[model samples]
Target: MSRRDFIYTLSATGAALSLGACSADGGSAIRFGYIADYNGASLLAIADKQGLWKKHDLTVEPKVFVNGPVQIQALGTGNLDYGYIGPGALWQPASGKATIVAINTLAYADRVIARPGINSMRDLKGKKVGVPEGTSGEMVLNLALQQAGMTMKDISKVAMDAPTIVSAFASGQIDGAGIWYPLIDTIKEKVPKMKEVASTEDMHDHIFPTVFVSAAKGKAERDRKVMKVLQEANDWRAAHPKESIALTAKLLKADEAKVAADAAHVKTMTTAELVAKTKDGTVDKWLDGMSDVFVRTGQLKKSPDPSTFYAGDLYTKAAAR
Candidate 1:
């Protein structure tokens, strides 16, 4: 498709979304950025519907962005204040363009699928394994190999994009494919016999948490009151999974069935849970885990410390209220 990673990984695909407004101010008005995707903006939609914004007397000018980079860019330029972001775009924060404020959803859709006989990650050893070289598929494949006590050197890595990898798999050119949903779904429809051998869920010690990000370079000052209200929304999302799905679809302006399918791959948690995780150091560990993946994959020269981008203290301050 466009310049992107695999779909259902939440960084994939586009939707017909053109909603929101803007008003400049502090106490009453806030310029919020969000993508037209469930994993990114679902909680905000749910919270808004529950009157959390009004409870806090907020007039949020909710802006829809295409992807993380675009949202980060807007934040950097002071065009927006806070928004949702995916794991792949954490580099934006690491570079001082935005700051990680809170956790959004934990997504576990990255997969490595293989022919029916390939029952485990080890089964793909010495086989032609195709993946989009720089996508989450590649990361999941690397993690899968490590879990299987193997590495890329042990397999034939056929480096290609999502579509090409799917083509190769469908044509039997590769014994397995490292990819995510929608694309993985496409491969399944074309090659129904293929089954999942490994997924992000298998990497038990690691996480793929989408986050709520705010200004790093932008001029807007942080507001503890606003953060408190957003946490209220998060609380609602954790308690109402099914209703949240319906509102998230409307926020994304996407097909409800597609949204439902994608929603299954995510874990929604309350603000108290997120605060507890941060206090217990799990949030820092998760950020560092993703950082390590980026470094190992050549996306970063070295891993940046979580304190450089993560604002766990800030999250705590808000949640305490």
Candidate 2:
């Protein structure tokens, strides 16, 4: 069967099989995948569960992935229309393949937790630190090390995903780590001696998770739709933080307190407000800080200009709306 025939067959099969199919404008449908380890990233869940996409004339079939890299890979391959996730996974795509449509949530919501005997950054030297490679958690940890006049070389770095890092910590294989909620909260509760030593605080305006909504292949126009959906969702979140928290927490299977804490960490910004902040070079300062940490630690070959990767069309449209 041809690709079109296959899509039709699949859509029919979904309808017949009782699984929902993608909904699109005037007969167009789009697949939108999300990560299930929601934590505070469940803004999409709230929008989805409440049928917000339908109100926008969209048939976004939301699927869940296990991690950011997988979710982003799906986005890059045309398997997803759009999703909310951290910008760290956008580096390669931002180089040429895709553009970040908008900022989602920017909260440091990430912190570094150390073992009982590890009391300071100085104590971390020669100790093992576990982090999911290429994640904001790791990025924050790298920044913290640099701020303390140290590098990853000063400590043994264990590259693993969130679950693995947690397991390693539990097994006493890693001395400390930079982690996000609810795992961060879970770890603290489970490990009596584990303590948070630092967070994304004092990083200037860089304290929130900058979510990216990527465009599908040959779908630049759809980027506008993604942005609109995100803007509406953000507005909903702002007006109903409690409802957002309850719904998101239910979907993520996390506690209300943890979800609320995560929400509190996010100082939501309007698209226009974010652009204005960028105009004043606050984003530049944040990226510069990120670049400095990467360059100093050899994560980046050189400090590239931050502006090369940003796309403001979505923000511009959202502002106009």
Candidate 3:
């Protein structure tokens, strides 16, 4: 079946199974899906390990996925009540299969790295560039190309996951890659000559927000409570940075120093700050920009209406609690 058809089927299946998806605690212990790439979802990992979810009267069943789009597909099929996803993989929102509830981390985590001798985006022409299709890596690469007066058509696109991309770059299978940390860090360590040609850090207006999303039936009052707990967890991290980094490194099975460095790339907001940002149109503006980038990259035929997918009211109500 076509991708769109598959997504439609998943949504229909989820709607049919919605009645049984919730648990006894008003759906507090909902199934959560996340990527294991050691990004902002580490906050969720911290919450799970630190008993923050339990503190908020919630139980969680954490599911790990290879990438955001796959996890989002599960979310559409009733396999997950909540998911932590990047904006580029949120095509489900355009189709009315899910709604973004809260922003987890906003930062400059995505990067485009070039193998030595190809130092600029313009030098990428005719070169093999690796990225996980339908993820933020691809989106960022497209933006980088646009900035250089080029497009995906200018390069030999290689679809691969971050770790595989690292291997490919090391083996000379691909000349460059657009990937996110801590995987980008891995590539840099493995290939000392790799040059970071572009990054979200250079695109200040183009923020990378790892957001929390829920299926239609998953957006219950209990789910809001869960988000509130996530806000509380962010507050805890801010107050206890050392402990948070140690715990995150343990959960990710990554180097403590690497985790600490990764932590610096992302900024988590408090409940009040989340509410204020969403209310002041900042979130909408960012979503609009994200949609444009997706469309420009041929990921979407046209941009979806930001209002349809963004549930700012969810964050507003969660913060009010």
Candidate 4:
């Protein structure tokens, strides 16, 4: 099935309700939210399938959402204890409603693809550019425009969800789009001429960190253990690369080679490394930059103090175990 079709199937079938059978030990259960994207949440799937959560005393019930905004809303309402989200989704709600506990991966996932004849970022001026408004797709586009000495006003902005943006791109409805995989990969397969003009790889410093977020109320002892075990799962993936790739590919129903290649682009950190980054101001610096982009995009009225949103103590404690 197509990426759009696959997402529709996930939504219509109530995929969240089928996150494996509930744990008989109700006290150990945790509601985990994640996007059904290959790049971001595949590790969570690997953990689930490999029984890592059980080892860590977490009976994780996976909740799948279509996009980051919806997942953030679930988190804000306390329906989810933990979720994976991009920096664009994290910054605004994280300022008050949620706390980011871990940076799961630094991924070169987002891409700016232009239709035929639009050769450069400058060529995108005066053309229609599609972006998923509230997610990292828009953030990356905004950053790219700023880097090109332009603004959103320089182009006609078309806001759509990632899948629809891919459809629009295929139909020649939008001149280009700022999107991530597997939509980008799907689009390229259908529209071979789609030119990739920019990506997160180009905006290295401005890139958004895909993170694990939780509401303040959910940060109990069990939730903290969940975070640590997630790091343990990441370490497991690194140590057992072949097995990791096989399981993730099977879960995502994607090709193992493609999954392996995509996985390579993501740098997963350990619990100790996470603590060090948090302490040395690296996380703060990245969030500060993202906050400025959020304000410029009108996603936030004012930038919140970037330091207030992190829960570094969780990782520090998790690492101790």
Leading candidate by TM-score: 4
Clashing pairs in 2: 23-59, 24-28, 105-209, 106-208, 106-209, 107-208, 107-209, 108-207
What would the C-alpha RMSD of candidate 4 be, to one decimal place?
2.7
By summed lDDT, the worst window of 10 consecutive residues in model 3 runs over 1-10
lDDT of each: 0.73, 0.62, 0.72, 0.73
Superior by TM-score: candidate 1 or candidate 4: 4
lDDT of 3 by residue, 1-321 (tens): 221111122222222212233344675347777665445446665676677766776766666665677777887788887888876675557556678877777767888889999889999899999999887788789889989999888999999875578679888899988887767766676688889999888987676677878885564676678778777777777677788888765554556787777778887666677778888988887787777777777766888877788778777887777
Better candidate by lDDT, 2 or 4: 4
What is the per-residue lDDT of model 2 for residues 1-321, given as tens digits with 9 covering 90 to 100? 211111112232222212145454564566655544333245576667667677677765555543456666676777776655653554433444445666676666677789897788778889888887766677778777877888878988888887777768877889999777656655665577887777777666344446665653435566666667677777777677788888766655556676676666666765556667666777656655555555655656666675665556446655576
Candidate 2 weakest lDDT stretch, 10 residues: 1-10
Off by over 4 Å in 3: 1-29
* Predictions: Cα RMSD each: 5.1, 7.3, 7.2, 2.7
Candidate 2 accuracy as TM-score:
0.81
State the TM-score for model 4.
Answer: 0.89
Clashes of 2: 8
lDDT of 1: 0.73
